[model samples]
Target chain A: MIVTEKQQLKMLSSAEMQLLHEGSCSLLSRVGVKVTHAGIAALLLASGAQCKGDRIMLPQDMVKNALAQSARIIQFEAPDPAYSFTVNGPENQVKFGTGGQALYVVQRTSNGWVRKSAGTDDLKQIIVLCNQLKQVDFITRPVECDLPDEQKDVAKAAVFRRYCSKPINLANLVKLARLAEVLEIIGNRAHLSFIISLVSSPLVMDSSAGDKFVAIVQKDIPVAISSCPQGGSTAPFSEVGELLQLNAELLFGFVLANVVRPGAKVLYRGIPITANLYSDASPRWCQPDSIRRVALAAQLCRFYNLPCCGTAGVSDQAVPSAQGISEKVLSWVYEAACGGQYINSALGMLEQVMSVSYYQYVIDDIALGIVKEKFSKAQSLAISQLALSAALEVLGCFGIEPDEKMEAELSARIRHIENGLEPYNETYIEDQLAVIEKAVNKSSSTVFMKAARKGLREGYLYKGARLDASLDLAAVAERLESSEGLGT
Target chain B: MNKDELLEKLEHSVVMGHLDADDEGYDGSMEGTPGTLELLEQALEAGIEPQKLIESFRVAMEKVGNLFASEEYNLADMLASAECVGEAMEIIESKLQVGNSSNKGKFLIATVEGDLHDIGKNIVATMLKGAGYQVKDLGINVPAQAIMQEIREFKPDFVGLSALLTSTMIEMEHVVRLIKEDSFPDLKLFIGGAPTSQAFADKIGADHYCRDVMDAMNKLEQVSNVS
Candidate 1:
């Protein structure tokens, strides 16, 4: 786990937080939320909410009760229990993972980088890469595959089980009904993690998304209501408006999820992207404005006593160039310093979350290791006081120089810290490439077949055996075993 | 007020983003002076030339762009300015023709399909209009067929495509190909956005690659002069 030091910065004061909370509460009770799913509307109405058409005005007391039902600390279980991560409470740590639903696979060519439509092999390769990278604590469907639209969800489930053991966080790209089929297969498995429950921008939950969340909650799965409110378009142009609307949306989800299953694991996932004033398009997440907005959202989540999910380290560059490096590094540093228990979209994504690169994934894993070293470790105040007294003693002696023994000791300690620092050089990347090569070599026919058969089992492993022709698991294993190399 | 004075106030209103006397400017000031739309009415009632009024609108919008570029203003400021220009243009569109048509020509712009970003597109449209070109904005998520339809009906001298997302930027190539294959062979085509570059323009067979709104204006002027 990535540890953090005590925070010395506060994005919002108590009064400001109180005002925002109260404003959201008032908005929830007054303007209400438009829930497109009739079942969810019925649940809210049965629980003392007033409904006018699609809008459901939840009572403040009911919202508070729902808030009270949240889990302070959510243990995200992986297939291996050692890989599981907690959401909030005393963890005070950050975990990095890949996030995107991009259709393109940005591959390095002989000339330069070129973006091509991602195939199932590309998706499987991402899972294999993340599985070996220790920095990636969890896995999400990083890139969209080239499977037919109807077969998307089952394809993801089949591929995810075949390669990865880390907890999975799924996007909302799959059709709700098909997504339910996929989830039912992984529902009882030890590796099944939370789903990214998305709500519409500006306080509206569409029919399908509402039903999806309800089904997810019915399965007793954890849901993180990740809302993306672009500053100028879907949300109000002002920062205040963005903050208020984002908070209101999350709170609305919190209420809805609890109403579906009280005490369900719900995380407040806020992704506040800033719009470029000239184009009204969001720049990369590295912008100071975007970071600041996310920090405020984290602070609001803290006030509501809800776990926060955030995105950082994504770049708008199409290639793994200097621009991509700087953007990803700056964003990781900012989010690490600020607040976020689980930093989504922290690796392997580019072009504003529109593409993923295998080379970049390996490079980003190395970059995150460097950034995590800067995280200050927690120390006892008494130990700090003793060090301070020693400093004072040295200061009391003014111009007196230390002996050679003392000087040597100080130099040794400095060297220790310096030695721990690993530069993200070419050799490091080559080393990671070697690791990927080793991983590919190990995907033997026997190992691949075993995992495939286990994942394709009845309700215990997966549901619905409507496998696609392109996803021939045995053929994929054969191809990987016989291919020359990844051609990195 | 005198005609020149009224026009000046109209320009100031656009720069300040005062839609009307009732528009509370970005600041707390509610200067009771008539806004750009209202002052345009006053200037027209005073029998001021429509081209002259449009010229003032152009100047004000340019200031808005400059302020935004310099970081002195923001989205709300430029949007307010554009909204003001839109309101005034609606009033004088019938009376207005492309002013100084000997020097400039009409331009059609759109954000290609699958991209819902129009802020950059809006900036270019407003800047082109202010630069004395009759601009038709097709707004966001415009399919290639729709853009081709507009090109046929509007017969613009230039077609500009904007795409903020890389996924949607691919659509620009399709749009460009369709336009080239269609009857509009002489139609000058350009592309711009956060993800677009000169290399992309070359690969897609577009005539010009604009880095920003200012670059777009400059290139359009150069192309207009050459053509």
Candidate 2:
């Protein structure tokens, strides 16, 4: 899937993006990221990063140099050569893939929707089901194996090799000691990729993930350095603040990857979602605020011309419904239009990445097909207009009729996505940095949550009507009934 | 100001979630004002009894808890208030007699081995501290041996284990086994994190499973009352 030149949506102005880039550089130089791995810290220190105790502070030149040295285009090879794809930084190409470390499998039974713990069997069935889905360009491990830690990597890799013929993304390497065996089981590194959250939120380098990332990047394997900072908790609640922090985290990974091995194939995956402060403080993955921030992350990745691994379509709704589908349609459209090169977690995720549904996979395939069709015919159409039209059409197909209120709510969402919520100035960025620094120094998000009080009062999060009508899953059921190896 | 007024200001500052003179308080506009710490120091200098100050903390925190329960205050507000109380307790702890400590109980918490995530653990720790518990956070990725050693030395009244990943959840079970294998009587074990549940806690022999910080506090309070 490719987002054409005409369909590309630029949410942030060029000046705003430049300011964000400079803000990231300033944050890297001033506050710095806490690197627990001594060897990796030494590598970064030798490469012009200043050492401030445990933190490794990279200079602006070091960040720019690392960005220059990183590979701009990455080739994702599949077991079947025809399914392989290339993600070029300068192009508007987009690829959708299944993703999540979902814990439960949601199935609609005669009684009601029941969620069962997902295991190795669910992993195999998901892979088989995704293999037949037309829109899933790649397969990121959606569920973890029930095996012990030592055997998990190898077991998951073996399952992928057996059931999935598309590009395989064995999401994370659980144990570094088993990496060799897992690679051997796959037999070809070209068909395999991985995602590592190398840096935790608020600029803390995860020591375990750091080790795995070093080992994987040393082998020249394609990996995405992901950083998911939930605003109002792990990150600043403001949009500008969260993006600045998220970008700095991912840029830290880029610098580390280049330091370990220059030109290491790494994708920039930044998911700056928000926490629902109104309730349980749980992450709102597909909400309007999150959709806007995630789309802006994709846009910023394109601004750096880095290979982007975007996250979209992870619904906050626990069960499959009209609301979930509506959220997914809007998320996929905005993410792709805003320049996500290789989007992961784009299908079958539900319950805010806690669970996945087999029926939702078919529904997403059909919904994504509708989105792509809208994009193909979207010549000279504004992305917001196209998104609204596509979402309405998809919902109508699933027995949903959008009333005027729903349309008004969606328009408000689009307007929010199109506008900047906070000022992108040096003073504002400094304040945001101070908030992040306070949280990091205290080793908690208390400062962030405190700062979020104002944002919440001012309605930083979107309050819109939910399209909560039940989704007609008749077509989805029919498609799943015909699909092979689902074990239904 | 008089002792009564000073104590009143201290309580108000805490309810406002103000920490020090630099804190912005709950609404981001109270940075220049004297905050909880300043007001607490003032009350102490004014010859207010440490026990009275402890009573004020309890009152202010109860108000914060009510606000949080009613959804008038979010986690950040509650956490900020908790942080204020936590910092204030550090100051007030020195003035009290040996047996007159304000701590409700001692808590030892950690994110189990192989888990680097700590937001949940940090929240629980801060809340426990704010709720008048003497908390020793062992931090993330702490091995069972270190936890056991800490148990021997610290002798906490409660132990809370946290793990975000399922892999580390297994480590939680392992840590629980090691703790149970030891002869630590009257030390209740609690498990929490995104992956943990009541079923998991029951299977792993933990005394309780905390869904969140409030649940941890409420459950600990309930157990305290019962015992």
What's the i-RMS of each model? 22.5, 1.7
Structural similarity to truth (TM-score) of each candidate: 0.69, 0.97
Candidate 1: tens digits of C-alpha lDDT, residues A111-182 = 767888777888888887787776898897887666655787788887787677788876553566686677
TM-score of chain B of each: 0.82, 0.96
Which window of ten consecutive residues has the lowest lDDT sum in model 1 chain B? Answer: B94-103
- Give candidate 1 misplaced runs (Cα > 4 Å): A2-9, A34-46, A50-56, A88-90, A103-117, A184-190, A193-197, A232-238, A278-280, A316-330, A333-338, A376-488, B22-33, B49-51, B62-77, B93-227
Residue range with the least summed lDDT across 10 consecutive positions in model 1 chain A: A459-468
For residues A1-488, write the lDDT of model 2, one tens digit per residue. Answer: 77888788888889989999999998999989999788889888888899888988999998998899999989999998889999998999899999999989999899989999999999999999988999999999999998877888989999998888899999999989999999999998999899999888889998889999999999999999999999988899999999999999999999999989999899999999998877657789999899999999999999999999999999998888888988998899999999898999999999998899998899999999999988887777889899899988898889889888878877887777777667888889888888888888887765677789889878888878877787788888999989898884
lDDT at position B176, candidate 1: 87
List, for all models, the DockQ compared with the true complex: 0.14, 0.59
Cα lDDT of model 2 by residue, B1-227, tens digit: 88888888889999999999888888889999999988887887788887898889899999999999998888888888988988888777765543526467889999998887777888888888888889999998898999999999998999999998877888999999999999688999999887788989999999999988888889999987887
Please give the C-alpha DockQ score of model 2.
0.59
